[model samples]
Target: MKQPNIILIMTDQLRGDCLGYAGHPDVKTPYLDTLASKGVCFDRAYSACPSCIAARAALHTGMEQSHHGRLGYEDNVPWNYANTMAGELSKAGYYTQCVGKMHVHPLRNYLGFHNVDLHDGYLHAARYGSVPYRESQFVADDYFYWLKQELGVTADVTDTGIDCNSYLARPWMHEEKYHPTNWVTDRSLDFLRRRDPNRPFFLMASYLRPHPPFDAPQYYFDLYKDKPLREPFVGSWETEEYLRKDGRIFDSKTGPIDKELARQAMIGYYACITHLDHQIGRLIMALIEQEVYDDSVILFTSDHGEELCDHHMFRKSRPYEGSCHIPFLIAAGKNVLPDLKSSSTCHAVVELRDVMPTLLSIAGAQIPDSVDGSCLLPLTADPSASVRPWLHGEHSYGEFSNHWIVTETDKYIWHSATGQEQYFDLKEDPHELCDRIDDPDRQNRIHELRGHLIDCLKDRTEGMSDGSRLIPGRPYPVTLPHATAR
Candidate 1:
């Protein structure tokens, strides 16, 4: 019984329904759809947190944000932190490697993994959608510096947002020669081509697109120029959308996002997603070309999802379905094709944290007891795996005390700064239009979710063995690497 290799493909801020397989009307995610047809499609795959750093930390640590405490994109991973799956797998002698946008900290290879390939960094430069005035960087020279040093692919690398008018006038929506996604995939292919297939390996190829700047390559834009973009009836820039930004909206807040501009933006975003899907296709092709596709297992998902104006919110970092519910697809080796690929969907409200343990289990590596996420093997085997009755997520950074709890039917959110509590019955309001928090009939559900939320906080705090952390006023060191500047 030889151990199988694992390839994890992460696309930043991808939504579930945005793919053709997921019933996307206009967006053509053909490769992803094909991948879904061969494996399990977790229709309701959930993220522990919507923010980039906190969500990834929770995912990798198999712990909730409340437990791991690396709350923002800037907090560095603690040196003494629990050994991650990468660390444990490396201990078991797997050839573990990572490429692309590494948003987590302790940026060096502390996961006990071998060969840390820091290809692209995630921060302001990679942020898409509407980059707020405060955090937007028009120049990305730092990213280019590393690209030239390593891949020799060069671009102006300057933050383009500095002169929006001038930047838009440049003709190309994205840098033609060296888009970040292209660069990441380029290096990843290079690494894959020189693979030692005899040994078991874990390869993480992460991409930071469809995440922000809402910028897509010119060709991708051309691919979706005529798509229709419709804003949700329940969303508005004045309220939920504006609030979600936390004052990050760079454009005027006079009214809702223009319908055509919204359409254009959606086209760009979907195009970027398609671009990413093609990259995965290339990697998968590489596997087939190398005759390793049948010998390996490949999983494609995202750290979290992006809210493309679903709640009128421009990006992810919110607990809406558009942001937290990502597409989870797994393609087992060519031999034992998964049964639930087509007619089945995992209803279990799972978290990204489950990834680490699940990968370890499948790889025949020793699963450590430190992670908070359980192995998702059962769910993968059978779509109706008894799902968690209730799930919790949190992200504490820069005055954002975002925490959420979702049960079989109810979704409750707690925002401390505004002293607001929101409740929605997902069963009835799939679009999340009606807020039933004030309804007397839903009081019991609210109370139940609140109790679960408290229990979750307490459990994570106790398990973490650290005092609760305070949200900061500004973004600081996210325990980032030198490649992030690129």
Candidate 2:
């Protein structure tokens, strides 16, 4: 069998439920729908960690947070531990390239690809702050430079999304402006057209839109104006902290979501997704035009999911399905693998870490045992391919990290800072509308899942660092200011 080339497509802050094929009536993801008709779609794909840097570090490096150590927004992933997909492919005599937002810190540094044109999925306030590279090497932030040169746009421009609206809300809703997703796609297409085809190649195209600033081109925004956006999941305001954030996103009008604002935000998100879909379509066409489509495996996913006001939250930072779930579809070389569901959804709980091994497996490459996730090739080919029943997600909020484990029967979440515990019977209450932690009727099931979660933590987490207050699987930096001296 000829080794298949890989082209991975990643969109920032996209959700598993947003695509039209995923039962989202309003969002028009035609290309994705067509691809799904011929490929496999993992309906319950989840992030290992909900935050961008940490989650993506795990995905790219094929290691847990403790192993790679990118635990927060600004934290860096250790590039020395092992080979990433790019590194592995490069060693196997394939030319690997990256051309979009990969939140793994040091831009092209931790990324082991041969060719890199890096960008962040969203505008990082840290871009102008500190980094290993000089200004010229900061490609994601170059949007500002490019926008100024091309559109003469400035930072002082007041976005209509935030400024003044009574019926509508969300800080950046009215502020229409140039966004990073659009630019990432443009640059990626440029790379695709100009790519050298001498060596079988692997290129990652990452998008930054639908993540924040909720900005989009006028045509995209207009395209989704009348689409029926998915409604907020029930019990969205159950958590006091969540309620507080909701107030802030709507009150000050600097950031947040209201009912209508959230609706329009969905349209903006759909617009960005449609924009991304078009770019993806163009890339697929480029691959066909270049005649590389026959021997290549195309994988589409995202770092994690956007809250999209799913649970009265504007962004992802929790263990809920909305925050952790994502869209993962793979087309195995000119449609070798027959479509399993014809726009189907897999119920298996898959972690982002699994992506590395699966991609390597399909490429006929060996994945190091040190990497934790199992190869998902079998699952893709046969819908009955089984994986872990539980998908765990961990995240740090303001220096505090919370751990959660989701199983087929129940869900368990634990916040280390306050020792807050939450339990939900997912089989019964799919939306997590009620907390069943204290429900004695299901205490036995909760305890069983709790033990399972502890076992999972034991198996995946490395060990506790008494000084850092972190367990094995999750890691935190000692100097993040929130880290007080012992």
Candidate 3:
């Protein structure tokens, strides 16, 4: 059998439930909905360390947080993984290319792609005055450099005065063709036109939207701006500590206090998603036009989800579903795997780590010994199959740092800084509106999940847990000692 082409479509800060197929009432993702209809959607996919850098580390290296050594969000750290997904596939004779958002240190570190057309959208660290000219986005990022060339040196992503992390949003200031989202697709289509046709190709078309600077083209904003959207999920468990920062604070991680502002934010966010969905449609069309659509295996997912005012929170790096749960689906070309299931949903717990092993399995390539993730292809054939009983996830956010355990039906969260605990029966309360942490009826289940978290942390250098119980208030570092050594 010929090796099938692999296409990975990645979006930043996209929620698992924000697509039309996911039954989201407000968001309209016809293209993604069609893809999900022709694929198996992993209903319970999550990011163990729900932040861009950490979740991406897991995806690239096929290892969980502890193994990959990135536990939370931190910039400027070197990515030194020895066996990356692209690198391993390259070794297996695939011509790999990534068109957007590597998000790794030194800006141009390709990890393992044969070539990279980099654009890690508006990274503040790379734009710092202390950063060398060679490493700064002006020279290091392909999209930024091209934007300047097309519009002159003074043009910048910040020209609209919207901070990258701000909840405020508006339409793009430049031509729609020059938008970073379009630039990624434009280059990706160019790659298909110029790729080595004899070898099976691995193309990662990553987009940086539905994240921030929520500047989708005006048409997308018009799609949902006046529509009645669902209000943010504000849980009963929310406390003053979590809601203290009002939404007016530009980049407030908490409340928008103003309901109208929240609605506008949603408009911008959903608009970006629909715009991204159309771009994905373009890529699929290109594949068919290139006559390789039936010989490609495509996977779609995100590094992490935006909080989007869920529980009064607005960014990622949390243990909550709004931040951790992410969309995951795999659609294999009919010619490549005719028996693969379509229009199915899997309840089994999965994560970014599983992407590597799954794709490698599809490509008939060797999955490295260091990979801790399982191939999910088998689950597509049987949606009820079990990959694992439960998943453990964590993130190191200052006072809100947390560890969590999630199964298909429920979730348990523990705040490391304050020793606060919250539990939710996800089956009954999918939005996580009510906290069952103190409910006597659910104590046994919560205790079991807590034990899972303790076991996960017992061997850590920070001593976050003993074999028996969790020990809170331990110093948390973004990259563990093992990663630093690398």
Candidate 4:
């Protein structure tokens, strides 16, 4: 049996319900929908840490947050994992390449990819005062360097007057072809043209869209601007105090209070997604053009999801569906695996950590003992097969820091700071509109879920659990002790 080429398509902050195949009403994702039709969509996939840095650590290392040591979002922490997805694949004789958004520390740390064409979008840490010229994004980022060459040195993505994390948006200041999303695809297509034909390749086309700066091509914005979009889901658990942030703030995590601005933000976000979808379409076509379409295994997912004003939240790092839930699908070419199901849906609980083992499994590589994730290829054939009973996720955001347990049908959240609890019947209220924490009928089930969380935290250094019950008000660190030791 020959090894198959693996293409991992990753998007930053893309919501699980924002795709056409996922039954989203407003977002148009024709290309992604087509891809999903030929793949198995994991309906319950989530990002355990629900932020860029931590989520990516899980993806690369194939370890849960506790093992990878990123409990939350923190930048500049060195990625020192001995075994990574790309590293293992390279060992298995695969030509590993990543095109965009490594999001790792040092800006240029390849994290074991044979080569990386880097572009981590508008990192504030890299652009801060007193930073060395070598570490600056302008010098470290390939796409930014190219943009300068094409449009002059002063040109930048920030020229649109939008903060990278801001919900404020507009079309690209330059032509569509120069957009970062296009550049990722452009470089990926170029890689296909020059890749060694004798060996199976592993390519990660990571896009930094639908995260923020909400800039998309005018055509995509136009597609959603006139459409009647749905309002953000506001749950009964929300309070005025929690939702009191001034939405006028450029990067308000509480989102825009102004309905019009919120609407525009949605337009920009959906447009970015559609624009990204088209770029993905281009790569799919290129795969076919290169005659590898029938021998490739393509998996698409996001690091985390955007809140997009859900529960009055705009950014990630929350334990809500809009923050942790992500789109996951694996489309294998007919020649790649025998009798693999297509146009299927899997209900098993899965996470970003699962990507490493799954891809290595597809490539016939030895699964490292250090990997905590399981192979997902089995679920592609048997959608009902169990991978795990439940998943535990957490983040260390200030005040709103929380731990959560999610299964196929429900979710239980515990805010570590205040010890506030929220439970939702995901099957009944997919939008998480009602909080069922105190409901008499649901307490037993909630207790069981809480026990799962307790077990997950009992052995941790944070003292979040004392073996029996969760301990609130415990000091939380973004990176755990293991990460610090590294």
How many residue pairs clash in each candidate at the backbone level? Answer: 23, 15, 2, 0
lDDT of 1 by residue, 206-241 (tens): 777676655556777777775555454353212654
The candidate that achieves the highest lDDT relative to the unseen native structure:
4
Q: Which run of 10 residues does model 2 get worst, by summed lDDT?
A: 477-486
Question: Any idea what lDDT model 3 has?
Answer: 0.90
Model 4: which residue pairs collide? Answer: none
Candidate 1 deviates by what RMSD?
A: 6.5
TM-score of each: 0.82, 0.83, 0.98, 0.98
- lDDT for each residue of candidate 2 in 1-486, tens digit (9 for 90 to 100): 566678888877788888878887678888888888867788767886776776776777676655555545554433444667678777777777787666543444635688766655333344446654543333435555565666555442124444211223232332233555555667767776776756667878877656665556677877868656557775832654645554454442122444566677677677777877876787777778877777778888988787666556556766777777789887755544443344455667777788788878766788987677888777775776678877666676643456777865668877655566789877788767888888889888766666665664564333433332334434434223311110
Residue by residue across 87-155, what tens digits does model 3's lDDT show?
Answer: 999998999999999999878999899999999998889998799888999899999989999999999
Q: What is the overall TM-score of model 1 with all chains considered together?
A: 0.82
Q: State each model's CA lDDT, in order.
A: 0.64, 0.65, 0.90, 0.93
Clashes of 2: 15
Query: How displaced is residue 9 in candidate 3, in Å?
Result: 0.2
